[model samples]
Every structure is written in C-alpha cells, then in structure tokens.
Target: MGKLLSVNLAVPEPNPAKSVGRTGINKRPVDGPVPVRAPGPKHGGLGSGLVGDQIFDVQSHGGDDQAVYAYAREDYDWWQAELGRELPGGLFGENITTVGVDVNGAAIGERWRIGPDVVLQATFGRIPCATFQYKMAEPHWVKRFTQAARPGTYLRIVEPGEIRAGDEVTVVQQPKVRVTIAEGFRALMLEPALLPRLLEVEELPEEDLAEIRKRIARSTRQRD
Candidate 1:
C-alpha cells in the first residue's frame, strides 16, 4: 500500500505576466483531512476546487477529468537532481503528494480507495500549460515537462470522503490491459505511434478517445 505524503492546498496570487492574473499553481502543504468530491462536468461550470485550495482558470482544470492531481515524491526527486534546486511537495501544482506509489504506472480508469470512503479514479495525465511554465520561471519548462513524460495523474472522485496526510492508499481496481497514465500522456500528447495502443483502453479521456477515432478513420480512408 502506498502512503499519502502530504495534502497541499493552492494559494491564488497575482502575476501580471501569466495567462491569468491570479494563479493557484503554488500549492503549500496543509494538515488535517480535506473533503474530496466531484466538481461536476466542465459544461456545467460547477466545482468547489479543493476544500481550501483554489484555481485561477477553471476552463482547463477543476472538472471531472482533472479533479484531483497527484504526483509521486520519487518524480520530485528526479527533478530536484536535474534542476539542482529544492522542490517540496506540491511544487508541481499537485494536490496530493504520494510516497511508494507509481502515479505514472496507474492505469486509466483505475480506482484507488483513499482513507475509508474516499475513492478516486485515474482519468488522465496533466498537460503542462503556459500558466505552469510562467509559475516555474523556466521558459523551456513546458517542452522539458512534455519531453520528460512523467506527467502526474489527474483523478476523478469516485466516492466522496475525507483524505489526510499519512492515509493508506490502495488500488481497488485496475483495467486488464496496460493503459497506464504515462502511456496515455505519450499517446495523447506526444507520439502518434502510440495512438493505436490508447484505443485498447475503454475508459480513457474523452478528448483522446475522439482524437484516436479520427486518426483511425483517416488511416482507414488512406488504406482504401
């Protein structure tokens, strides 16, 4: 069983250069259990963000597919070594920092039972944006992050409940075929060769689902 290292809350601040004047990508560690629930669909435009956390732009975030973001401490260590800087938990804008859990290895549609009642399903991988690039103060960060391909897992709340630091997280369910979060990122965002592999997973993100279908259709036409 993997452990929840820390529960981080975002603090929105002003930055004139960013896509949004207010930014919530700077997350800080917090104590105690925080409420976890679905924020509804993007079309509905309804969500509470995190309990004490916040988001500047809801259009690209805060929906069902990207409800809860999680990252492994091991990945943080990798960045720390590469960048030669201090990276605390939540530095990457992830709400939950995990230890001993392979966040990238988690399959799409996999369910994790957090605490007692809180359950979260892996939906997609985080795609870094210009807001994130500005936050990091690294101009090449978006390219670097995308090339690294260890994008954190974005989760949807399966069963609403409370989650706190030191809680045990166990994989309650995983898909049969290996459509891991990492593979999903590579296929959907970077490499077209991986497109066919992504189709094997049924519960993948809707955006990727539609794109793959289009790609298949285009290929079939060429074959004809």
Candidate 2:
C-alpha cells in the first residue's frame, strides 16, 4: 500500500517544442478531489482523464492508456540529489505524485485501488520527449533521464471516480508478467535486445505490441 502525496493538474504553458506552441507539462498540486475517467483514444479524445487537467499535444499525449501519470516521491528525492535542485512533486508532468509506491517497479497490468473508488491499471512507462527536455532547460536531459531509467508509469482508469491528496493506494491485483515499468522503458528506449521480453506482457497496448513484433522481425532478418 502507498499514499497519494498530491493530485496535480496541468498549468498550460507556451512551448516551441510542440507544434501547438503550447504544452500542459507544467503541473501543480491542486486542492480537493478531482474526477478521473477514461479519455477514450488519443488524438480526438478528451485529452486528460482528470477534469481540470489538459493535454495540448493530443497526437502524442493523453488517451485511455495514458489517462493518468504517476511518479514516486522517492524518485524525486533521488533526482533532487543528483541535479542539486528543488524538484517539485508535479514537475515531471505527472498527474499524481505518490509516496511509498514503486511506480517504476510496477508490473504491466497491475491494478491499484485508489482511495475508495478509483481503480487504475499500469499500462506503460513514459518516454521522454523534446517537450520534457525543453521544460527542464538542461542540456542532454532526455539522454540523462533515459539513462536513469526511472521513467515512472502511465495508467488507464479502470474504475472511474474522484481522487484527492493523501488518498491511500492499494494494489488489488498484480499480473504474473515479469516485465516492469523500468524494464519496459529500458527495453523500448535504451536496449533493443530486451524488446522480446516485452511480448510476455499481453496488457501492453496493441500499437506497442505491434511495434515490438515489427522490431523483432527486423532484428531476425538482419541476423540471418
């Protein structure tokens, strides 16, 4: 069991990294409970699972699979020590900032019951983008973040409801899959050799599975 430290919402900001010239990466902790529900698919969907939150880049961000983003406070502490700066709770664009939760270690398809009603299932790990780098304003931030391999987890709303700060998070179900968020991130971004391992987790989005299969096929042909 873990605790929800804060429920953050996007504070839209202008950015050149995105085609829209704006981004919702600037997230801040909000007071009171926020409604959460599935935002359907990407692109023409609702954008964000949280009511007040926004996602400017619909093509690349937000959807049913990535309805909610969560990062562990422990990881923030680590980054703060490494960067020697104050890393806030929602600085990583996560909707939820959690304490005592192994967000990176969570297995794909793992379901968590949050507070009293909301149920969220881990889908994938966040991949760093130019928008994130621009927000950080640090040279090689994408590379550094990728190398660190603590990319946090993106979850889909299983049972929609309201969530607020200080809510309790309980892992109600954990799949038998061995692939974890950290392993998935490393495989998809850093090392191609581990890509095959991701296939064992059926809960991954269809598009992602297709990409993994395509990459595996390409690698096999090259080997032959």
Candidate 3:
C-alpha cells in the first residue's frame, strides 16, 4: 500500500486548439501544469487532456506524471531526459502522487481503492509520439522515458467518488493476472492484440465495460 500524498487538479493552464492524439499536445515543464479535458468514453475516457474520471487511462493521461507513470522518486532521471532540463519539482501534472508502489507491477485491469471516494483501475499504458519528443526537445526522449521509467499507471473513477489530497491508497482488488501496465502499453503500441485480456478481468465496471470492449474489438480486427 502506497501513501497517497497529494491529489491535485486544475482546469489545464494553457489549452491547445487541437488534441494531441497519441502524443501529448502541451510540453509542460517536468513540474509545470498542463491542460486537461473531460473526454467521453470514446477516446478511452481518461486519455490525455482529460481530468477527473479520465486521468485513469495511462495512454490518455499526460504531463509530468506520465514521466514516472507511477509516482516514485526513482523515476527522476527518466523525466529529466524527457524535459532535457533539471526537474524543479519532483513530479508534475499528476493528480495523485504517492510513495511505495510498483505501479508497473499491477495488472492491466487491476482496481485500487484509494480512500473512500475514488476507485482507480490500471486500464492501459501510454505510447509516446512526436509530441512527446517535441515537448522534451529530444528526439530520443520517448525511448528513454519508456525504457527507464515505463511511465506510470492510469486510474479510472469506478464509483465516481470525491478524492482529495493526502488520501491513503489501499489495494482493494489486485488482479491475479500477470499482465502489467507496461505490458498493456506495449500491446497497444505494438500489436494491439492483448487488450481483450483486460475486458475479461471481470473487475471493470458496467459503465466502462462496453467502451473497453469496443476498443478491444477494434484492435483485434486491426491485428487480424
């Protein structure tokens, strides 16, 4: 169990005209704030540029938190390379910062009960794009970030409860599956053939089931 230190949220400081898609739009500082949106269930719900229930998608969440993927001090080096500069703050653009938890170890469809209000699910992994390279000003930033940090896991709002800073995140449901956030990310970025494993977890909520199922079907056809 990791101690949830802070849960920060803002309206996204400088909004972009268009969405970044796979890559992130704004290249915020390692500790700087970025924009967030409320994506419908269509675009993984919590993908980048989204907040609240949306921050839960690893592929969808953006900013510095993505640098660590999980809030850990060990991820400092990876984010520095991505920014091409020193990190002023330990973490940035992360709604929930915590200590002690191998975020990447959790299964893809794993669910975590943080406090009483929030339920976080390790849905998917993030795939870097040109936007990430551009933001870091390094052509090799994405590769470095992925190799070293593997980013972190995303959390969905299962029950839709209020989450505040300094909350204690407890593992209410840890999936038995061996699939991890990094594995899920690679599956999406490379083969797109493994997403079905998550849908079968049986821990996902009904509201999120159909949307995740739809993504899996699309990916399966692409691979086929």
Q: Tell me, by TM-score, which candidate is best.
A: 2
1 against 3, candidate with superior lDDT: 1
Q: Which candidate, 1 or 3, has the higher TM-score?
A: 1
lDDT of 2: 0.94
Candidates ranked, most accurate by lDDT first: 2, 1, 3
lDDT to native, each model: 0.85, 0.94, 0.51
How should the candidates be ordered by TM-score, best one leading?
A: 2, 1, 3
Candidate 1: tens digits of C-alpha lDDT, residues 57-130: 76667877778999999999999998889899988899999998999999999999988888898988999988
Better of 2 and 3 by TM-score: 2
Q: For residues 1-224, could you state the per-residue lDDT of candidate 2 as single tens digits?
A: 89999999999999999789999999999999999999999978998999999999888899999999999999999999999999999999999999989999999999999999999999999989999999999889999999999999999999999999999999999888868999998888889999999999979988678888998899899999
**70, model 2: CA deviation in Å?**
0.3
Off by over 4 Å in 1: 17-19, 214-224
Every model's TM-score: 0.91, 0.98, 0.59
- Candidate 3 on 126-200: residue-level lDDT in tens? 456544455456657667666653656655545445544455677777776667776666554544566676566
Error of 3 at 186 (Å): 3.5
How many clashes in candidate 3?
12
